[model samples]
Target: MKKIFGIVVVSLFFLSSQVNAQHKIRIACIGNSITYGATLPNPEKDSYPGQLQNMLGDGYEVMNFGVSGKTVIRNGDNSYVSTKKYEEALQSNPDIVTIKLGTNDSRLPYRLKLDSNFIDDYKALIHSFQQLPSKPKVILLLPVSSFLKDSERQTDEVIVNQVIPKIRQVAYEEKLEMIDLHSITADKESLFPDKLHPSVLGETILAKRIYESVVSKKKMDFDIFSKIKEEKKNSSFYGYDCVDFIFKGRNCKVVKPRFSASGLPWVWRARFFGIEPQADIALLDRGFHLVYCDVAELFGNQEAIDCWNAFYEKMHGAGLSKKVCLEGFSRGGIYVYRWAVTNPKKVACIYADAPVLDLKSWPGGKGKSKGSQEVWEIFKKDFGLSSEEAAMDFKGNPIDLVPQIVKAGFPMLHVVGDADDVVPVDENTKIFEERVKALGGNIMVIHKQDVKHHPHSLKNPQPIVDFILHSVKF
Candidate 1:
């Protein structure tokens, strides 16, 4: 009788995963624990994926195929039958497949030994998804945060630390769309009453995360002034539970496949979102800041003005905020060089990737100037410094600013490639790293021995993210 009942239940769950025949956007929930939400009062209404399907509106069908204790390599049954489930998902011909697995595999921050072991398997799964006749888009959910020790608190520590890293490595390798669902989950209070399965509310938050990643499109910066009108919060960066720190300046921000830590809540900042944290840990966890201005030094261009104003207004209204982290890629690094010199006291750290710091070494303007006409125009217009005196303002030059950097001092993550064509990896990062290191400063360099150009991000992204996180306090 139990076997018959189990078969009937599996049949219903399987049927629920299939689309409603007319076909809108078909999504698949392929994981465990949170996907099933057996701990919720009502599994149908409470499972994260189930709630996701509901919140996603009338145009979507989501199939939840999460088997608790299932890992990517093997679900402890030591069989590749889980691949069959994916095959079934492919047969359904869904437009997208969202994977939230790996929490079971890592369970703690450092259980995995070799990168290839777990990463290769994850790559295999991606390849398997690609093998689908429909060729659905694959979006990986960066694993959520776990307890500090993972002892009596959670069972998914391995996914949070070890497996998720490998998965990210694979995402970069495969070029799949990814979201920061894990970070959102981590920042959120407990979703489980027993410290494991998600409550019904937790399901809603997770589902909304997947929906926003696949469906929504938002500009980099959203409205900040309006939110301040809506929520009566205190402090410059709101320090409440379940707030996304990175969204402090921007209003409608969306992190389409999030990058890493704290990237989750950020993913849904532009769209309607939710964060269901556990009751006990709600107040204990210090939430993420509302706004963070990365590379405010690059605030010279018309491109940088709007973002600066938004951040400035928020900081002004809130009184004072944390030191901003300065991040710049390619020529934008030159802006970092300038911002750092003028306001070193306000900056927390520097992240320079292929920055063009010197006009003499590698002249500026992104392929705009036929000669130096555009250059002189920028010097006169953008700097607002008299052309005659601009030359003497040698202090703002990134190359010249090394002395100030040494004196003011901040940690830096320098990533450059030996064969970069766009920014002449040699002139930009090589010399900058050398000069900065010569002074007393903390700098970490990821020099790709043979790789070329911007492609270096595909190699190691965590180091980039680590630099961003390290720039913050509390």
Candidate 2:
């Protein structure tokens, strides 16, 4: 009887251990050299996956299935699907999988086949993970920026212009969550010692980002409308509840939707608030919040940018989406474009109606339009332009910022009155469209045959609404 009791106790203990192990959430880190911690001193302990495990604590099991010089493209030089790590990752039976491949696929030899095989192979890989009995939640990661100056091997331009877009397309089509790792390391050259792989500090940043994305669960009890009501003055905006408040000494307003959207997507209106608000009304109907901050007469100056910067932080903290669709009308164009250029990653898309692209064209009266001398003087003073020549030489116009704006990779749409003497299409939208198209930037221009600047937005508003919805992936 004593021997029988001892056997039963040991068996019970073994079953308890198995149950505890199964309770921990398993995460499989799948990627190329960067995920493998190629250059790090101690990959096992200091790698991003290792660091992620530590950050996730005992409640999670993080497995690093990264292989060096691996490509997600099946026909690429070294296909990730063919690797032993891929098989092991499948065997891990993870609850979540993070795929961060693409760096090696950007190489010249492999890049040639990317157009044909990338999307198909990527889908196949995701399908493989989805077929697993675990049915893991797969997260796509945009590869980190490669600071390598070489044009052939992992160039930033190719990654940004080519590879990243493909990945975004796949994510959108697959309806998968994507973490923009490319933007995290962009312009942070010091963090990448060899220009190819991230240093230990950089790995820490990546790990923290992944942890925030996968491990941290946002509190569902917090309601944005409740918070707004508690803190701000309430009003009505086109039949919707509008909350008014002061942020950074600027008058701000947020129009609440009857039902909040899945992502809490929002449109940030610059300058104009309620004039010809068809698009705003439509967006509100589709469960989008309409937000505005009074930066009028600021002319998209440094002060305006600073005000917007603070306003953005407050809204993001209030649980709004990380990116916003920008709407600019007439002079409001300056405000939206200026802010978008500075905070490119923060913007999802831009819709400008009769926008003032070049200050010299409208306010400065340097172009065909009969300009506003009063506003021009204010603009010059705001920009610190000592004379007319200085204003002429000013390169801060949206037209001048086309390259940076294009590189930011956000789509733009312009609605212009072909016959308007004020903020003429020829000087503003036409020039902007031409320049944007030249650089392979995405821009759509809608010319209202005989309309003027007085009428802003479309009568139907369907096209504008569709553009915003598509850009934000709603």
Candidate 3:
């Protein structure tokens, strides 16, 4: 019996050693509400520990070191909650330790003013992880928005003014990886539950921010499906929501944003970055925004035309004189060509990729079936004209608009794929580009191989942005 017991103990020890050898990587996540997911029940991974562990892959075992109601400064009353948990987790000799805290330390409730001493304490906390036995890569987790200071009920002004710049500065100086969770969580009310704590999506975004930042720093291809662009290095491509700072040129005008009966659809604008937002100030000052419109609202024909009309009216009122460069997908192409024929002087360029330009060209179009009869109804109501007259008025036919485009000498750039069965390239972009060139206009067409009508920003995300950036003329 004694001999059998000894053999069993040896077997158990060997098995444990084998398991440890199989999983060599260790990661730890430490922080307060956002990290522990306060409003949320703790899952095996509700914290960033689970998020990062899953991101690293099957080999990693990340420990959750986050604690709710924690602050960086303990105030000698022993109120600081995170330190104890962090110390315990470090015993495993982690390969990476992430510290996500300090917003609570900076906010008014705890009233913990962050002076030099506080910064020193943060430095020490960072140093402790740096000096760990494994000496893991340390990343500083920046905080997003604090609770809105009431009265605004909107967090746009709050985050843009107070939090983001400081966080950016910290990352720049410390040479630590900055996970810009604030970028996605800007409209805190949207991402948050009570407008104080984050929702499930927000927590997921927080995890995503850390995961991408760490992975991208290694300069490896980000394996995540949705690869959102993040601000990198000292090169400042701003996420500042101070929209007033964006000047619309001509008479040195600044658009003092006023909400119409429509409370300025700030949520939608923030959510959909249709294309890249980076722009040179000099180009904007010379009149670049006039040609672009957010076609997110358009799918139906009449609705699309109305949206274009509204955009044009606004540009005219703004005294925008510089020629505009136009780019959009599907129904947006319909609106752009329709307006360009009439207002030729205003159009600098146009590029419609996988465009829904002609009604008859589409499947189940109003020409064949009553598929778009609802759209036809709205068209009659809006322009008080018959179907044929309104289609001619809007010139839904880009081919018809060609004579006017030729006379105007507008430059255009297009990207489309032959594999796009929805909007066949030959019928749309191929024919249109040929017409523009025939009309003595310089048009650049990039035929994407085996792809569909995707935003140039969506595919390898830089060239189309560069084209737009350079396409503008003063």
lDDT of 3 by residue, 238-339 (tens): 311112211222111121111111111111111123343322211221112223344433433455545555555555444343455565556556666766
For candidate 2, write residues 1-474 as lDDT tens digits. Answer: 999999999999999889989999999999999999999999977889999999999889999999999998887459999999999999999999999998888988888888898888888999999899999988888889898988889888888777877886776567566666776576578989999999989899889878866743323343576655335987766446678888777788988765566688899999779987868866765667899999988888899999899889878888889999999999999999999999999999999999999999998887788899999999988888899999899998899999998999999999888888999898999999999999999999988988888788876576787799899985
Error of 1 at 198 (Å): 2.4
How high is the CA lDDT of each candidate model?
Answer: 0.54, 0.86, 0.53
Query: 1-474, model 1: which lDDT tens digit per residue?
Result: 999999999999777756455567788777766666666777766787778878787788788766665566642442233656665765777778888776666542224333545676677777777778778888777655554455533345555445655776676567555565555555445664555555666667667756655554423232333344434332211112222345344442211222212321220011112222121111112122333344333324444444555655455454333465555555556666565665666666776665566653334423322224455455445555566456435445567678877677777776677666656655556666688787766777777767655443422243455455556532
Worst ten-residue run, lDDT, model 1? 263-272
After superposition, candidate 1 runs with Cα above 4 Å error: 1-20, 75-84, 108-116, 148-157, 218-474
Best by TM-score: 2
Residue 297 of model 1: what lDDT?
30
Show the lowest summed lDDT stretch of 10 residues, model 3. Answer: 258-267
Error of 2 at 36 (Å): 0.9
Q: Which is the leading candidate under lDDT?
A: 2
RMSD of 3: 16.4
Candidate 3, residue 448: the lDDT equals 74
